[model samples]
Target: EWAKAFNPFFAGENADWLAMIPFGILALILYYVGRELLLSGKKTRA
Candidate 1:
């Protein structure tokens, strides 16, 4: 019971989860663009 009262940072749990959302989205988008460029660089119909 006292431990809960002692910690104040736990209030940001949802905020912490929200913070990572943009980074995750950017990383996924980066991977997609990189993959597209890498495959497009190859020229061959075999």
Candidate 2:
């Protein structure tokens, strides 16, 4: 990921918050995708 090299450029001094964006976005996408799959199953009415 270009984020690696770009990080030092933008991160500057405070690296903690700068590094969290990628990880936070990943977790959010995974959670939403999993939720969609879980709710995808439907029951048929007799």
Write down the lDDT that model 2 would get.
Answer: 0.73
TM-score, structure 1 vs. true: 0.49
Tens digits of per-residue lDDT for model 1 on 1-46? Answer: 6534564434444666766788999888889778785345767788
For residues 1-46, could you state the per-residue lDDT of candidate 2 as single tens digits? 6755676736567687767889999888888779875455786799
Clash total of candidate 1: 0
Candidate 1 regions with alpha-carbon error over 4 angstroms = 1-11, 37-46
User: Which predicted model would earn the best lDDT?
Assistant: 2
Residue 14 deviation, candidate 1, in Å? Answer: 1.5
Clashing pairs in model 2, backbone N/Cα/C closer than 3 A: none
lDDT of 1 at 23: 93
Q: Which RMSD values do the candidates have, in order?
A: 6.4, 5.4
